[model samples]
Target: MNSRITSEIFEATAEPDPEAGLFLNVATNGLAVLDRLGLRERIVDKGHRSPHLIMWSSTGKRLGTVPNGPARDPERGSVVVRRGILHHVLRDAVREAGIPVTFGARLDRIEQADAAVRAFFADGRTADGDLLVGADGVGSPTRRHIDADAPSPAYSGLVGLGGVARVPGLAPTPEAQHMVFGRRSFFGYLVRHDGEVYWFANVTHPAADRDALRAVTAEEWLAVLRELHADDPYPVPEILRHAAGELGGYPIDDLVHVPHWSRGRVVAVGDAVHATSPSAGQGASLALEDAITLARCLRDAPDHATAFAEYQRLRQPRVEAVVGYARAINRQKRVTRSRLGIAIRDAMLPMFLRKAADDTRNDWLYNHEIAWQGSPVGGRR
Candidate 1:
């Protein structure tokens, strides 16, 4: 079988600096997919083990501890790695597999016939295939090609900024990430064994203010963050103070649902169909799950249409559930200005955490395993 990957970038390469790009928390479920693909060890080697999330209030009160990955296998928990490193690992794996990757081939439109599909690129090039899978991310044009009425990505009303910094004298947060619900923002950071801190801050804002947020300079954003986290507990302010090198910022967005995942010979996967906020840290993992599932569907199903239908049917519910879960977390991370609300949250959070821990509520998410053996039981729609 022949496979090809088309990317919009001029060159298919990852950021050279290890700590330069966004950090991804790849849950065990995502690691499981990489394990299936024989790349799990490579990813784990490049990342820090993050199995737990320790929550805290602005007043330095430890809120509670939550498991970040499945409790069943404590040894193999989530791994936090730089996005660029993950990309490099996956890209190298693809190259080793001899898959042809065509960089700078931005899709302009899709033309479909009874028997095949053609992707027309902006560079006056075209590629024919039996089916076209759109992994083009949240702003996927292929999604529109499948269904012009597909829902646009909705802003989560939170502005996200993060960077890596080496803060001396900081103790390593082994196997955990610390989350602080600050007075005006949410700050999360994890220190590697080497004392390098990977940190991010989420500031609440109106969706309409995205353009304004984007217009702010990196230095300006850093200043804003310092102010927001000024009165917060230890390390947040310090992390911001020492932050250097490419600080990334964006308005966090998610697609609650896309009505059409596929049309004719075209199908959408990953953020194209279902996008979740960064709160749950499952966005990358869910995309990995989609890749494995879609491959299995196409391999086992008799035809492309059946494969697409089965893939959507199997995946839509799981991804939507995850999105809902992340949305709930996003609500918690939003700035709580009311003292009463803050007090109430702080008072009730321990109980909530206890209940969640007792019941192992997130097992469904982190423990998800893709079984690639059987053919899908759905017929052509």
Candidate 2:
């Protein structure tokens, strides 16, 4: 089927910023989908191979390691890349496939007919097609169009901040990313072969005070981060001190459940439907899974209604499961001032990690494979 993409961005250029600090950890499952589209090599080439996540405590003690993805093929594990570079690669791939893209076409409303759907943009343009997919994200207008009472994104009680920095003589973290649960916040970093460090911190903040948090200047935020990690470890402080450019900051929000994913010819995908916290590192991978599954359902089902139902049936359970898992991790990252609580968490985390590593608990997540050529799981028409 032919498709068209519309973006609110004023320009069609993919690289919004060459030095954008935002990064994504695309798991093996996500890479599998890219491989199916013949774009895996192109995307992975621009990323660092991150195969394991190593956790540390505020006192600099190792809290065991968890495989970033499945261990079946070590080479095909998770990869860390700047979000802008990933977007550029995918944008190029879409262009190469001859799919037309319209920029600055923000959706103002959607009109649906029995046999077709029409999208009205704020810029006085309209596009008609057999279906309208809402990949617009957490603040999706299409979501409300499908169901007026759709649930709004819930703040994850964490304000995320990060930036790229160069630390002279810093050793590269080969095939791994380091995470530290600090006294006041949670920090993660990965070093590239070129000595450039990609780091991010999740600070515990009240959801009601998001606006106040946003009002803080970048320099002030950096200073707060430095003090948060000052007594934690060596590199955490050093990385924040040398952070380059304007650091990116945003309130991490997620949607665990949405009553309706589709109404008529319009359907939501990715963050528009079910968004997860970055704690589990499954946001991008789950979205890719949705794309592959939805395409197969559309191809195999007899009609659009059947396709949409089957797509939701196949996706909702898995998506909700992952979101819940991420929420659990987010709770662990929440700052605890009580010394007893902190001691309990530090002691229990190692045991939990050991069990998880021994049993391959995340197999259901990273080992998921999309059967593109197979018929839809449910034989409904």
Candidate 3:
């Protein structure tokens, strides 16, 4: 997604480091689209997992043991991607681009007027821009500084536990698998290329009290995870048995509403504007979409004001739809003693999946692109 969007505004930064991350499943599908467009070359073993640049020379022999699950369609031949792998790959590529990337830097203030934005950082220096995009995460400093009263993300009454498990001969058939048992749920998929099985489960009960959730000792946290997955499908127990104490927990939250996503010269995108639940799996994809769309809008509009409007015009409906869908999915995960309800809910998934695929295929999105000429901000048309 980032590759597709970035190519529209800038030259290919570097051939995509496919080996730097896990590539398999739906994520690879999107990546393959970019690769086929000649924007990148898929690399093998790009060296992820740490900053140490370790390569997986033993991948070939261990490849057969990989669990290809239902979530992936071998027929589609899409790339499987891991969240961490994408982050590391994109982070390294961005740094190598000489595009002035910064980490751990804090923004202190934002001043915007006359179609320009100046962001002041804690270092007592400021970066001025013809356009400013708040690609920050859910607790966006830009959103707060720009609109203190803008809608905030609220806990969606759920918590998620995620981890990677290595169970030697227990590979799943197909590519990826999602199992919703009662109100709780589990989603597992094999990341292609990297050869690891990653899974996440949603627990909607007990709506973790943030303070209590964080207060638990490491041992207590593991106990809680085991308790949550006790009734889940095969190997969930075994997966817990080998679980690394790396376990962590956080309350899930979503933006119920946001009156304004852009104001004056400052505009917000992604989680900063509409943070949806992970149950939707569109959070990162949506954010990447925002970055590219914002660039395109600013490039195509007659001026900053027009571009801002165009940005909202193109994104609002799509974000709202996802937010609504996310909330609805959350409702399903909260099931309790509702057998009839579960049956009906299960019946709706196929329809929901179809709609989601259609949403991505819509012309207003996925198909939108901007030419790679002119300044990053002035390349309209």
Candidate 4:
């Protein structure tokens, strides 16, 4: 949601900077940026602090993504935390900064007034705000209220399984032994903060029986994976063979279009407006970008209407490009077929990676910064 990128698109121009880590930084630091701006707080809870953070590996190997400081992984490109965790962190921060929170208080409706957002809740509660950001996710009531004709999210024809296990850290070789099974499926190995090993598998499935998936025990999942991936590379079978407890399975979905992101005083962000397939691993990053950009535009615009216009103006094209990329990558991930399909996939991966690099290079999303003005607090109300 950086204006640099947004403005470039509006002017039919290209971004000046498109480094690999540009958007990655914005995604990871979005909450931290808001906290630093005094709009939120830095929270530290004992059991689970950031619920939305997903430690993963795009290739599904010992290459799982973990939180890092200044140094970063060179080969995996950019890394960002999941959206839920980012939201939790920011919510906690905002609370500490004197913003109240309404949990389990689902929004039933959002009605825009001349100068404020009148949001009604399921429990018949309501709140008024000069600006409203719909980060409520894929089935966002905010989006529904704003645009009843907004397109619904569609399945991307891919499903994923994620799990954590304790393995011989030295045996698997987190860096060296992390293996991939080509285009068939993705397998990963990760080391948790508590020294537990973690792994995830990206598989293509036509329809997911949620109950059947969760009903199976971890050992059962291993057996199923073993049978499905008999022809895969070495560690994939081995990793699943050693999987423990319940394995997690989830479907991937994409939202192709949303007519208008902003209408009067309400503006949707993240999956609320442009939910995307996970194949591109940009969902969280995109949401983080939305949060930062929304804050920046709302602060800069002279009025709420202007701010909403600017927000949509800045986010639409970039989000559309990203959504297209996610769908395309999902097509490759969902391939399960003839020898011809296998051969084409085998040859297309490298080309795909190269094109991905190029596409990101011509964008400014990676260079976003959460702009904070005034006392880093109540400058805009």
> Which parts of model 2 have CA positions greater than 4 angstroms off?
1-21, 71-73, 208-210, 375-381
lDDT of candidate 2?
Answer: 0.83
Total colliding residue pairs, candidate 4: 13
C-alpha RMSD of each candidate structure in angstroms: 3.4, 3.2, 9.2, 10.2
**TM-score per candidate:** 0.92, 0.93, 0.71, 0.70
Task: Please list the C-alpha lDDT of all candidates, in the order they appear.
Answer: 0.83, 0.83, 0.54, 0.55
Report the C-alpha displacement of residue 246, candidate 2, in angstroms. 2.6
Cα TM-score of candidate 1? 0.92
Question: Across residues 143-201, which tens digit of lDDT does each residue of candidate 4 receive?
Answer: 88888888888876666665656655424232321325344565544443454555566
Per-residue lDDT of 1-381 in model 2, one digit per residue for the tens? 323334222222333565664798988888988998898998788898998888998889889788888754567679999888887887788788766676657788999989988888887878888788888877888899999999998988888889889998789999989999897899999999988899999998877366687688889889889988898977899898898667767888889999899999999889999999888888888898888788777777778788899899988988898899999889999998898888898898888876544456677778788777654342211
Superior by TM-score: candidate 2 or candidate 3: 2
Better of 1 and 3 by TM-score: 1
**Location of the lowest summed lDDT over 10 successive residues in candidate 3:** 51-60
Ranking by lDDT: 1, 2, 4, 3
Candidate 3: tens digits of C-alpha lDDT, residues 179-226: 434233443333223434555556664665778877866577667667
- For model 1, the local distance difference test gives 0.83
Over 4 Å off, model 3: 1-80, 113-116, 123-125, 172-174, 182-195, 337-381
Per-residue accuracy of model 1 over 238-344 as CA lDDT, tens digit each: 99889976677788899887878899888989998998988999999999998888887777777778888888988888899899899999999987789998888
